[model samples]
Target: MTEFQAKEMEEQEEQIENEAEDNKEAEDSAPAEEQTGQSEVNEETLRNKEEEIKKLQEEQDELKNRLLRVQADYENYKRRTNEEKIKERKFRAQSLVEEILPVLDNFKRALDVQIESEEAKSLKQGMDMVYRQLTDAMEKEGVKEIEAVGKPFDPHLHQAVMQVENDEYEPNTVVEVLQAGYSLNDRVVRPAMVKVNS
Candidate 1:
């Protein structure tokens, strides 16, 4: 073959080989494109799943916080109810003590009667015994007499019905108690009517 003809034949063969290689590459790249598209879809789905999980976690946290607040409110309500019950019990006891005061006064009136006869003496002794028993019973129920005759005059526990100028006692001191006062649990049920020294 001549030199020019041989060069033209070699150029034609190289062109054919290049065309075959391009066809093979196109065949290989088709599946790669499909795989890349699938991968993108999977990544988007994974992101959506992550977002859903985060939202669920946030909702759970909110519910937990609400439960804690409800528990706190319930505990406060229970505490207030208990305090009210205690106050109600105290008031009830105070009412019963007030009702018994008149009976105590009647007992005192009976004990104050003076008699000299033998039968009357026995009766008086019996009355004194009954009075002592009643007083002991009241004391056991948290009832206590207010101190007025010797203690300083306090308006909270004593009512000054009369005043006296006395040298023996200090000013504003209670000289005599005209009527007794009673207390229950450090709360005064009745104020003592008393004479104060000026």
Candidate 2:
């Protein structure tokens, strides 16, 4: 071969090698950039998912707390209703007893009247028997008369209609019971009308 022709061939070969190396480097760097971009997208997606999970958990906890509060309120209402029912059952006979009190007082007044004849005496005996039966029934139903005469005056059991300056009784003492008081189950149905020593 001629010298000039050889030199031209060598230059062509060198240019071809340079082009190949540039293509190889561009291919390698393209994959690295693509990987970096993919990783950034993945990180963004993960952060979004975490935030969504946190919000959902918070909402679930709030709903659970509301459910617990409702259950507690329902339980309290049930307990209160049960207590009211028990109290109603305990005081069931209060109204009937109150209605019978006036009748009992009338019977007591009739028994206190003096009798002069045999027929009147017989009627008095009959009334006395009826009164005794009524009192026995009341006693069975937890009714009791409050002992106010000579007892220490208590506002809960006694209603003082008059105060007396009596030397025979101590201060704040119940000297006499004008009208009888009654109780049922240790609860005052009616307070005794009384005279108190001041």
Candidate 3:
């Protein structure tokens, strides 16, 4: 144990302490670096999740829009079908009324014939009531008679059987209704057989 030996031993101890401190610092910095890397990974994962959510929202919106369009189309289809049903019902009624029109005309002709006997007159009156009831039922179903006599003649509504020179009516006016015209729902079912003024 001389003084030179003691000084060399102290220098060796100081070198070992410095080496331990450096190792401790390296260990601390490694964890901090690891934490930074983990944070970056977490941020990337969060961004991916946000992107996925955005795509899903856009898909949901598209689906909702499509649903609304389909709903609207279905509603329009229902409305059109209902309208067609009403038109079909009107057409059916009109056809039946048209078939019965000849019978009504025959009844009118029979009533017009002169009858003097009491029993025949009574029968005529009963037939007239029946005709009126039939006409009333037809009217309720939107069946109507076309007014031809004394009115301005239209080729669409009247069929001209003949033309006559007359001062009482203007030219092309209907002077006589030889056969009754009929309409259903404002549409002509049968045109009036008419004599028009020349």
Candidate 4:
């Protein structure tokens, strides 16, 4: 072969090698670009996940607040119910005490009457003792007698049976009490039957 032809063949081989090297470099650069794109997608997914977590936390907080409010409402309802029960008990006690007052007054009237014999006096004393015991029991339960004799005839406390004209006494005055009145806890159970002076 001629030297000129050999030199031309060497130059052609070198050019082919350079072209292969450039192709390899281009393949490596394409993989790096693909990796960068994948990283960007992963970052976007992570940001979306963080935002979802924040929304869930907010929902949890709202539910906790609602639960607290419900608990407070239940507590108030319990307190109110207890207070109502106590009031009902007190009212029932007052009514029961009022019902027993008339029986006690009858005993007092019976004791005030005079006895003719010793046996009768002994029986009367026993009855008086029983009356005292009953009155003591009533007092312990907050029962009391209303004032009626020789006082002004108040419509709230007394029921006037007969009116009498008297210059010695003031008009609308209670001259005598025919039936005693009773009270339970400052509330009148029965008004006194009285004779009023006009």
Candidate 5:
């Protein structure tokens, strides 16, 4: 071959070798860029999952709080209903006891009259037995007599029928009980008629 043609062939071979090296560098850098992109995608997926977990936890807490509130309200309602029922029962018993007070007063008058007579001894005994039965029934129903005689007079339990001047006891004291007062379960059913010492 000629000298000029041989030199031209050598220069062409050098240019081809430089182009092959550049292509290999580009191929290696492409894999690095793809790895960086994959890492970013994984980070984004983790962040989304964390946010979802946080929201679920908040919702669970709210539901628990609501459940506790409902339970407390139910307990309060039960307590109130039980109290109302007890009050209703007490009121009913008090009303029934008040209705029988007049009969008890009549029995007291009859017993007083019978105890004053000697000829009516047998009749007095029968009347006394009846009085005992009535009083026993009243006691079973939580009825009690208020102490009036010789006690300090109270307008709430005693009605002053008359006032008298007396040196035997303190002034404003109850000296005589004309009609006995009664209470049912600590509530006054009837006020006593009494004489107060002034």
Candidate 6:
């Protein structure tokens, strides 16, 4: 071949090699750009998952609080109900005791009458025995007489129907018990009808 044709052929070969190199660089850059885009999508997905987890944790905490409140309310209700039951049991016999008080007073009046005849004395003895039995039964049921005479008058235990000036008792004191009063379990079932010293 002539020298001029050989030079032209070499130039064409160099141009072909440069074009091949450019194509290789473009292919390598395209994959790198795609990888960057994939990394951005992964970061967004991770942020969304973290937000969902936080919301779920908050909901769990709220549910736990509600459960604790319900448990506390149940405990309070049990305690209150037990207290009410105990109080009811303590006062269960109060109404029966009140009903028997008038009958007991009648018995006391009968025993107070003076009798001279032997037959009457025997009947009195029998009545006294019955009275004692009744009193003993009342004591067993937690019934007790309220002390009024010669004691400091208390509104809770005494009902003052009349006021009198008396030298034997201090002021605001109970001078006499007109009607007997009774108590059960340290609670007044019937307050003493009394005369108070002024």
TM-score of 4: 0.56
Using all chains and alpha carbons, the TM-scores for the candidates as numbered come to 0.68, 0.70, 0.66, 0.56, 0.62, 0.70
By lDDT rank, best first, the candidates go 6, 2, 3, 1, 5, 4
lDDT against the true structure, each candidate: 0.82, 0.85, 0.83, 0.77, 0.80, 0.86
User: Which lDDT tens digits does candidate 2 get at residues 19-99?
Assistant: 569658856765675676664767766776587579667766965786697689679979999999988776677899899
Pick the lDDT winner: 6
Q: In terms of TM-score, how similar is model 2 to the real structure? A: 0.70
Pick out the ten consecutive residues of candidate 5 with the lowest summed lDDT. Answer: 110-119
Model 1 agreement with the true structure over 1-198: per-residue lDDT tens digits: 458757975885686578569658856865675676664767766776587679667766965786697689679979999999987776666777899888888888878887889999998898899888887887877788899887899999999999999999999999998888999877899999999999
The C-alpha RMSD in Å for every predicted model, in order, reads 28.7, 28.7, 28.2, 29.6, 29.5, 29.0
What's model 3's overall lDDT? 0.83
**Per the 3 Å backbone cut-off, how many clashing residue pairs does candidate 4 have?**
0
lDDT of 5 by residue, 57-122 (tens): 775696578669768867997999999998776656687778888888888776675245576888
TM for candidate 1 is: 0.68
lDDT of 4 at 70: 60
Which parts of model 1 have CA positions greater than 4 angstroms off? 1-55, 81-92
Better lDDT candidate (1, 6): 6
> What would the per-residue lDDT of candidate 3 be over residues 24-143, giving only the tens digit for each residue?
785676566566666476766677658767966776696578669768967997999999998898787876888988987787787889999999999999998998998899889888
Number of backbone collisions per candidate, in order? 0, 0, 0, 0, 0, 0
Better of 1 and 4 by TM-score: 1
lDDT of 2 at 48: 64
Please report how far candidate 1 places residue 60 from its true position, in Å.
2.4
Residue 184 CA error for candidate 5 (Å)? 2.0
Model 2 misplacement above 4 A: 1-41, 165-168
What is candidate 1's local distance difference test score?
0.82
